[model samples]
Target: MIGRGSRRFGLGVLVGVLLGFAFALVGASPAAAHATLASTDPPQNQVLASAPDQITLTFTEAVRPVPARIKVIGPDRSVVNGGSPTSNGTKLVIPLGRDAGKGTYLVTFRVISADSHPIGGSFVFHVGAPSIDPPQEGEAAVTKADPAVVWALGAVRYLGYVGLVLLIGPMLFLARLWPARLSRRVPAKLVATGLGLLAFSTVAEMYLQGPYTAGTGLFGADADAIMNALGGSYGTTHTVRLGVLAAIAVLLRPFVRPQGPSTIDLAVVSFFAVVGLGTWPLSGHAGVSPAPAVSLVADAAHLASMGVWLGGLVVLVAVLLPKANARELGAILPVWSNWAMMSVIVLSLTGVAQAIIEVASFGPLFDTRYGRLVLAKVALLALVLVVAYFSRRLVLAPARKALVGAGGPADDDEELDEPPVKPLRRSILAELAITGVVLAVAAALVQTPPARSAADAPPEPYSVTLSTDLYRVRMELDPARTGGNSMHLYAYNPNGEPQTVVEWTVTATPADGSIDALDIPLLPVTADHAVAEPTFPTAGDWDIKITLRLSDIDQATVTQRVRIGD
Candidate 1:
């Protein structure tokens, strides 16, 4: 018999192992996928020609222009630019002030893009004279990944998926094995446990997903603030997940009741329940599963399988393992094991498939924050599986040895061979505990970018090429950032120099072809770039009309319509 001291030492060892496991997760927790300014417009490590007209810094994603400021450092490291940087969208620009003296200028800025992401970056450029013509600029919006949040929150997302699956996966497996009208209705305790886990993870996820998307806080009250942020891809997906979750909440009533379930009924219930739960990856980093559609489907399958496997173990220990009768367990363990093993295999394969899709290249795997966190997660998974393998091999097979003397039907060979396993039950419980930790880690991984980065979506590059006449004009929109009002115009006279014009008139009219020719002030943004800064006061479709007078008699006008969403 195990003595008290022996038990204490063993318990200490178990606690130490769990603590160590948690520490490993913590060590990896700080690592993140958040992309910061890798480099900037004027660039870091390089001497500049006389000062450039405007400044721009590049980051991992689309950035907004709110805290965007250019800190023009003096020889004493004092700021020069008037205040903050002016953001147009993809680039941040500062108007050159009076007689800008000679010296290196440090332009620092912070911005919140339309995506609700916050980014801070800086660059250095020199100005020779006061300045040349103003440069048309866009907002510096880079949608960087928050690695820490991704890792931490991802665990919640995936854990929620696991809870739903485990919460329901077994009933389906049992239905497949046992005939309809016979599978025991899931117990209230089991349903409560699953729902409890789901709720906990969801609360954690809400906190994580909100700020993580916008690069906000990890533990602050910002989660509530991020409600509107759900309008995006990640938000949209989680929204649907909520709907599926609601269904589960309602269905729990029927599921928890004590009644036998039919195979068809169980399958239908399990599939939809999981569908309501597992579809999260679809709108998240894993949605663009590397295997494409098949990979995506497989990911869902894998999630469902994991839910069944892990959640089932929880059920077994809580509901079946504690029972004094070995007979009931003997009859069910093997069948459950078979299904559990199958689910494990499926989950592993699908996870790999999704990983392949997310980590497009080897560089992102190590060089990117997302990649490193993913690798850490993979390590944790390997550890959990190691524990699982031990339970399956050493603890389980021998526990069945006790069944040798038990009297049972010969036809029950499978169940008959397995006496009520008791000692091995501890191993099952251990495995389930470790599995919970794994799910926590997985939750964080889900919130992270599948691939080290989303460069895979590679925005569709497009530009408007215009061939206007005598003084040929070509307007090309920069591909670095898309949407919003963006275009570059190059005009050359027959001699190919600056087109000295007697009159330059540009205007905007309603797209309705309204003869009113919308009366609006034409703001001169750049020598070559001009804009109609009309108060878009309201959100709607608006038209921009450009009228250029080369000499007064030689004027050309082009009208373009733009659509804005609220």
Candidate 2:
């Protein structure tokens, strides 16, 4: 029999898996920013009569060229991209070396999107004809991002959001609704944590941008890479944000005092805050958006309102409501309620505007990943708003009583009752929890590709790895639908060395018995690799058999099943 704790653990795992499956079904896909390859010279899998002298790539949006991120491998497994790429207005031109002779060539490219995010892809083309042996899978070396690095980046972003809520909400409360009885320690620690998070995230982002854009591993950053990152527009904006945070640090003393920031200090800091906040939009999707000026301004307003409203909620629930007496509650709640009402209004209007610009069309709202995330955010926000409505009603009860003359003056401490306190606290807590989910959705929105761009792209390809006793084979099927598909197969020995194949045979059989097995003609591009174009006639599971003959006496056959879509 399982212990209680073990049952709970198993249930939790099951629930998590169910949630993950649900998200996957709803297309909570991996992030890819707006910049997409519009067209490439010798398009994907194009069979050219002769080798081209240069490769030209045109993107839907202009991207900052990182030549090191682009690799062109010739049939002989040698790098043939001449040198640095020359770029001009959404187009990148990479000259090819004379050695890029006949046979299949693979082009691997990665570039920084206009929003400072990295996007990458790989495609193959043939010159004269497919080679007898091409580059193997292991030799391609297109590394997936390190999981640790991905989590680190996400953590930093989450911390930044948390910090903003802590700093902005409490500061507003301290300035407007803070009572004398509340201890300063709680809010002070919160403010300090927020500032520290902002500062640290900025620095961490600067460091990570190099490795992220270079398509390298976590510790792949070097002096040149870091400097190059710092030199870019993205880096410059982050640097400015850091400076603003430092200034805020120096002014913390004035900010924390009972007598808040003086007129000049307030103005100076407000200006810095605006400039610093603007940097976020400058380096994000908003900056690259159509009608960027409008989008940027709207996004900034949206962020500011989120800080004011959410932060205020945090302060109310955590500090004021708990410690304050009836008198203090009466005095603080009304003013905070009014502030929150206005902030919510601003947030709604601005959020709608930004959504319009990003979503661009109604179809994508449910069809694209970004739009799905936006819908989730709106749903959560609506829940918070409902809770806020009840909290506001509770806050107004005292004032309503005073207006009807059942109580004495509204300011009288003795006449106040604590009846609504518990209910109001619970409502605020519920609102806060829902808003936390909204923040997560918002963070996901920033990382996801915009709906307008994602909706226009073609379906991504399918890849699989299969193995036999002697070797492992990696295969990629481009556009694995009921049509013509390009298949690339790479075979490697047990020791990770490329294994030569004297003979190659492949067959595909439908799993449902609706169709018989058919032999696929695979042309050997190299001793370790082969290429084939086969038309899948229907949508179903296909059992793929790859038989490789290493020598006259040695051969092995591996079979794997793959799904084909309509």
Q: TM-score of each candidate? A: 0.54, 0.74
How many pairs of residues collide in each model? 43, 7
lDDT by residue (tens digit), candidate 2, 459-532: 66776667788777767788888989989887778765677888889999999978788889999887887999
Taken over the whole model, the C-alpha lDDT of each candidate is 0.51, 0.75
RMSD of each: 19.0, 9.8
Report the C-alpha lDDT of model 1 over 465-493, residue by residue, as the tens digit: 23346453433322223134333344445
Off by over 4 Å in 2: 1-33, 132-138, 180-186, 399-418, 459-566
Q: What is the lDDT of residue 402 in candidate 1?
A: 43
- Model 1 misplaced regions, further than 4 Å: 1-121, 129-162, 169-186, 213-228, 262-271, 288-295, 324-327, 360-380, 393-420, 447-451, 454-566
Q: Which structure among the candidates has the greatest TM-score? A: 2
How displaced is residue 155 in candidate 1, in Å? 7.2
